[model samples]
Target: MMILDQFYAENFGKVYRSCGNCGTQFKRIVQINDLWAVNGDVVAGINTNFGDTATIRTTQVDGVDDICVKYTGNSNGAEPVEIGSGPDTKNCLYSTSDIKQL
Candidate 1:
């Protein structure tokens, strides 16, 4: 696994990586000021995943804006669909079958 900080210096940037075993293409976006819980501390964690396509959105809550991630994929028409969506503070997981929006 690769640390998010290694790929992005700030949030709101695109990251590209390919699976070594399957050569599956993956893309990720990092949003700034993303909140994450690691080791009981709510610090900014690098949010990322692997997939074929992705979309990102930003919302304002209580006068503060936040970013969200959404991804979808079906690798070569395989079984199991992956979808993930979540705030910038959390990490997401994806599989080859489908996109997982966290």
Candidate 2:
């Protein structure tokens, strides 16, 4: 399955995967297995239907660069929606989205 977006936190041993086409989103976690475990001392898995768990090897995956932008704010407003060139201007990328100010 193709993964559309993924988020990971270092040392958390957790991975979040989101697929747009299949409408499937799930998280995988890795942990140490108890003595009764059969496969190995450490196990990584994700749950499927019927409460079944499938063992998997989790790895850090990185892809294309993401658009990381910082939004600034002011007491009145953060950014101006329109630009100026004799009234010929476009809105900033962050102008359309709803954002909160502190």
Candidate 3:
């Protein structure tokens, strides 16, 4: 008799984003092809249509795992940011940082 088995792994990361317009914090999930290197050896990337903000921070999920993206931002005025999965579609996730007034 013979048997077959399969295994899988769950990969996740964190992508940080700060609003250049209102200092709002945002985050999104990093896809497989939406990844880039930043600051030499630091994995960085951004979700273009993440939200109303223009710029954002992207980082690896873990020190080893290079999947998913986590966002960290202020919590004062910080609120959930919209991450667009497609045209006219988006998901909401709260920032992991506190907001500061400038």
Candidate 4:
């Protein structure tokens, strides 16, 4: 499995992974296990499902170098789907089965 996207806060984070060929997505919610720095970048230690709470590491990168995710607003009377942590966060990434946002 490879990471598709990730979002992190101080206490917790969510990593999204995709299974190869099958196009299945999995979300892993994790708490901070440890932290360190490498080459001026901060790396986070998180738990994974790869064999008994396997630890995985990640470093925060510049968002300008990453793909842009679509953000939606709830002004058009269409119900905005909750994709991020909650509605308060106002962060969403979604796609519908029909010809809609992706």
Candidate 5:
């Protein structure tokens, strides 16, 4: 699974907004395409959306929309969560707005 360090390096100036149980600030990030992290809980990709639990609505961070975002959620965890994944993991749409470009 793609760790936070690599994700951060590739997608600089981005922060996970949801403060889950860990609340480690920038320590954890959820890769929606894989569902590796959920509601702040870090887990391996189960190939399931877990029932569309999370959703990131529209919000502004430093007044920006287009930021460091990858086109697809393949290997790199830089893709915008909004772009979503396949049917198997489509429901689990985490808030892309929470991931802001600093």
Candidate 6:
């Protein structure tokens, strides 16, 4: 079976999406194009609107947006050694002597 699913987001002209489980602000639309594919009545008196590409959305956790930053941490068995803005900065997973997160 072929399943063609699309997110029907109709507004007076507009967006933000929510999560299912946590119910927090999960998705926020930065830009939206109402007309992904508008032929503008190309063939006779019919306006063909074909959707192209996919809808891409993003989420913000604890107001963390910057993905490129440095992570440095020191953990002497205290507070689990939190890193880089508290698990939001990019490349926070990697650990090393120079760029280490404790």
> Any idea how many clashes model 5 has?
1
Runs in model 2 lying further than 4 Å from the true structure: 1-4, 16-44, 47-102
Expressed as tens digits, the lDDT of each residue in 38-98 for candidate 2 is 2121112222221222222222223312111111212243332211111001111111121
Worst 10 residues of 6 by lDDT: 42-51
What is the Cα-based lDDT of residue 85 in candidate 6?
28
Off by over 4 Å in 3: 1-22, 34-39, 45-72, 75-102
lDDT tens per residue, model 6, 73-102: 222322222122212222222112212111
TM-score per prediction, in order, is 0.24, 0.16, 0.20, 0.20, 0.20, 0.14
The lDDT per prediction is 0.29, 0.21, 0.28, 0.24, 0.29, 0.20
Off by over 4 Å in 6: 1-64, 79-102
Candidate 2 colliding pairs: none
- lDDT value for model 5: 0.29
The alpha-carbon lDDT assigned to residue 92 of candidate 4 equals: 21
Residue runs of model 4 more than 4 Å from their true location after superposition: 1-22, 40-102
Clashing pairs in 4: none
Of the two candidates 2 and 5, the one with more favorable lDDT, higher being better, is: 5
Model 4, total clashes: 0
- Order by lDDT, highest first: 1, 5, 3, 4, 2, 6
lDDT computed for candidate 2:
0.21
Per-residue lDDT of model 5, residues 10-78, tens digit only: 222333323222212132234433211212212112212122132333322333333222211222333
